[model samples]
Target: MTGAWWAAAPAMLVSAAILLVPGLIATAPLRLAWVARIALSSAVSIACIGIAGVAFSLFGVFFAAWQVVLVALVLGVVAWLIRGWVPDAPRERVRWWWLASAWVLSALLIAVVAFWGVASPEQFSQTYDNVFHLGAISHILAGGDASSLTLRTLIEPQRAWAPYPSAWHSLVALNVQLCGVSVPVAVNATWIAVCATVWLPGVAWLAQLIARPFESGRVALIALPLGTAFGAMPYALLSWGTLYPTFLATALVPAAIAIPVAVWPPRFRVRVGRAVLAGAAGLAAVLAAIVFAQPRVLATWAVMMAPFVLYFAWRAYRPAWRAGGRHRRRAVTALVAAVGALVVAAGVGFAYVVFRLGLFERPLDDRLGGPQAKASQSVAAGISQVLGQAWPAGSTGTISFPSIPLALFVIVGIVAVWRGRRLRWALVSYLALAILFVIAAGADDVLTKLLTALWYKDRYRLSSALPVFGVAFAALGILVSARWLGHRAVRRRTGAVAFAWGTALVSALTLVVSGGSSAIAVVFALPAASAADEVVSVRQIQFLQDVGRIVPADERLLGDPWDGSAMSLLFGDREPVFPHVNGQWDPHRLLLAQRLGEIETVPEVCQALDALRVRYVVYNPHEFGGGDPIGNQFFAIHDAVGAGLFEPLLTDGESTLYRIDQCGRLPAR
Candidate 1:
């Protein structure tokens, strides 16, 4: 199984190219700094994929890798044609080796952690959400339709298609088609690429932007290595929900927030006509890419950018009020009115997206009850977790200790940046995020619901967002402390040598303390155990592999999706009558799910079997989640076997493949 990882090389290369090359080409005319370009490429590429997928669906063309590449080329050509309209800004001078070393180190650290987490490339997460994500990729491969607007048809075939973010699935499917890797391998490859390439560099770029006037180079170097130390993000998210789309979107958040600052620098003196237009257009393209990746992240980006926006607005317009005159009062009034109008506009937009569009509208009285009904921490505990950089509660199934080194660094960082006029916004942004986390993790009142419902009021999702800013602060904190110590040393030579050693020691200590915790180790090790058969046992997988030889590819099988039978869609190239474990299934599917075992007695069961063209049943009674009521929907199939209605075609231990001979033959499609 480990040898199969070598096959993932093609998938990794293809995934990286699909994610980076198009954006690199399109943004060439902008002439951004090397780091900035690398940070924004994945966002631009995802945006292009979203646009291409929608256009293809509308034009009745199949979504394919070749067509996506063509779309990117066209956009690049357009960018080149308009190159002369945008003015060049002064570029930061930094040695290429410095940046390369930082990136390589970060990539290596992330790769080691990822490799340790999933011991085999073919293994997949066995969490509930993974079922939909994996099935969505298979659906795309089988049907060649990868549009976000129609991807939900995998589970909701009866309803009119509504948009669900498919950027993650679309990219993985393209890799499978172009690189010939299995779905699991493609998923693992894409995840590693997103982490090493997108998340690591993005946070470093953001650190550079935030730590302005404080030597950007050192901050970036420190941030690159420290970004992976936090277990709250990338790791907790990987284990908790295996929320793949959220993971991608959150990884891009740092870049999305940093691009505006990069494009329109504080001292930008370019002409206000064409240059501004070009910059705005480029920013729009990147923002579109983020929305396509995950719409909820737009809220995350807005929360982080609010402080910057207010600060910038004040800095831009305060001159008029300071030069007091007849216009001074009018200027002040205009500023107030403008601020009020913006507040109103934001309120209206949030309402429209939440209430009108019906997004993130999980009821407070859901099956698992609501956020209010769950076990929660005290407000003090939540704040302490944020300050200490501890893992969110319930993510690791055990109490997590705070990283003392990280907490101290964050404090020093907050104090260090508080005095800088522009750099202080990083602290403010983190404060806002921390408040939101506190509300979700500690309080469960109306305010919590109002502020956090966009994230489904889930603390793990909210906690996952903290490290986006926490990493930047901690990096700044470490560099600031190192410089302070270096300046105060007794001798110049001793100070220099001592500074380097001290910085390396502190970084290593922080990484060891944060990344090597028992809790985080468990999180990384969970995937390997999940793959060991928490859902589908090793015997069940072998049973499916053997049954694949006898089952016709064109025919479908009926079974409880929770019992791991739906996996045949990938392993056996045979679609299940129910593609997922949960959905508002169509009448025929629902009828079969409930009464397929009674095919010998119920006329509707036979009718459903005939209509759905299901001639086989794959029964594995070891249902996931230990036979929860959810799987009971398909319990009637157990009775069907007991009644001798199914003719056994094959058997492997407890798993069996049976032909539905009891149901009369129907005309072939």
Candidate 2:
């Protein structure tokens, strides 16, 4: 098969895998049930497609197409295998309206990706997460095995120094293998869009779980617009270009928590089934863990859900034990869920250990760098930080359509506090926790707050503030609209439905206008660094290619210690020491703190390279003597290493490389 056809093969495999399991086709007697399943299936397809696209980008488009096919096959197999185990209740008949809505939302997301990809593909390059991770994968896929220290050194320190999850890298690598290696943006965008869609059903399911036995069609209905608004934040879209994949990972956390809690009551009765359910819950937790390494996300979800889990267990067993029925059974089920979840977590931890996962291997980063820490000192302050960053910039600090929604939620929250609705009370408690997170997140001395968050074992990572804030506002809007629908004059069925439709319409319009405005601002803010430079010398490029070739595939070559960004992206073997963003945002501090600020004499430069065990140095003459070209602190060291201290390695038309050979002077005093 052609490379493109081969690239698309993985999608077919994943799709078939999901579709052909023994019970997959059997479970869908009713059209509505099938529709929901299909929607989910489609989501899986989209995610695989996106991931494949990104993986292939590093290789080629043909490989990307194939990776999508593989992902589809994998998802299909999983869906098919698990088909029989899913809850089998025929609820509302599948409505055309639902399908149409799903289609529209999917279309919008696709359009957004296309617009960005075609209009500004460079935005996706050299991001915080992608560069280090993708570059590392590129190194591996290029025939340099993972066993090399080059891979280890580049990946390990980041795991120690930075704060990002490992799923994106792992996923990218998988796609590269399946899709071939070109460049992975197409697949990455597909993954982002797919991930964005997962939240819709996930939120619906969560609403159902929260409502319990009482059908929550209304809750689910409201979730569509509100969930989309919250999920499709500017950061998530803009971040697609960057390596930060938090939004993608966070998309599934609520459902993971909800699923376990939702089934607790029914599963408490059956021994085998309950065990399976517990395991499923645990699996969900594991998935959430994989997606989010931050403690705030974990802590918030746990805090919100833990009480409910405890209450359910207590209520379920208290009566049974008092009435002479078996209490051990329920206790055992809860234990199974907890233990299963723990087992899953252990497996994830092991994968992390084996893979040298994340920016840092030690757990302290997650534990120490979160908001939970700040909350402990002063709940009020933590809550403020959590609330501030939870919403988009313009959405907060002032009253507007989006901001008004938040204000209304606050008002309803007050009413709920006075009137005493149990669920509403729970929401209030969540808000209180959210406020604490806000405070911690926004504080100036955030490091202290991060430590506090970490101390809770990173339980506060969920930062309950985000979901709580969004849900609270959406719930308030629903309550208001429901009340309007209840008026006698509006008692007509047509009027009520019309009102619901109107609410959705207004919400969509508001989100579109607000999101559009933000997108425009971002487009205009691009810096010169983003543009392609015409002054790049062919000789300089050749020098880098040559150095890359000389560096042992097994041994990483550190760049000119000072200019890690351009060199790391363009030439270095191992993942760079610091993340691309850190290098970009604080290159001066990083260099100065790391002592790259003092390499004046040839001996100093040579000694520094030797100390770091660097094999090759790709020098940029223009960057070295120029006025802090990127306005980074790179110039601080330029004056230290005056022209005479170095010898030329390569001189192209526009640029020259200088080799540090230890001028006769002794090392610095």
Every candidate's CA RMSD = 4.0, 9.6
- Model 1, position 361, has a per-residue lDDT of 67
Best-matching candidate per lDDT: 1
Q: Which stretches of candidate 1 lie over 4 Å from their true place?
A: 1-10, 81-92, 115-117, 263-266, 273-275, 321-373, 393-395, 488-533, 627-631
lDDT of 2 by residue, 45-127 (tens): 33453444334444444333345456556545555565445554345433658644753453344334323322332223323
* lDDT score, candidate 1: 0.71
Q: Rate the local accuracy (lDDT) of all candidates.
A: 0.71, 0.41
For model 2 the TM-score comes to 0.61
> C-alpha displacement of 492 in model 1, angstroms?
11
The residue-by-residue lDDT of candidate 1 on 230-250, one tens digit each, is: 666676666666688988888
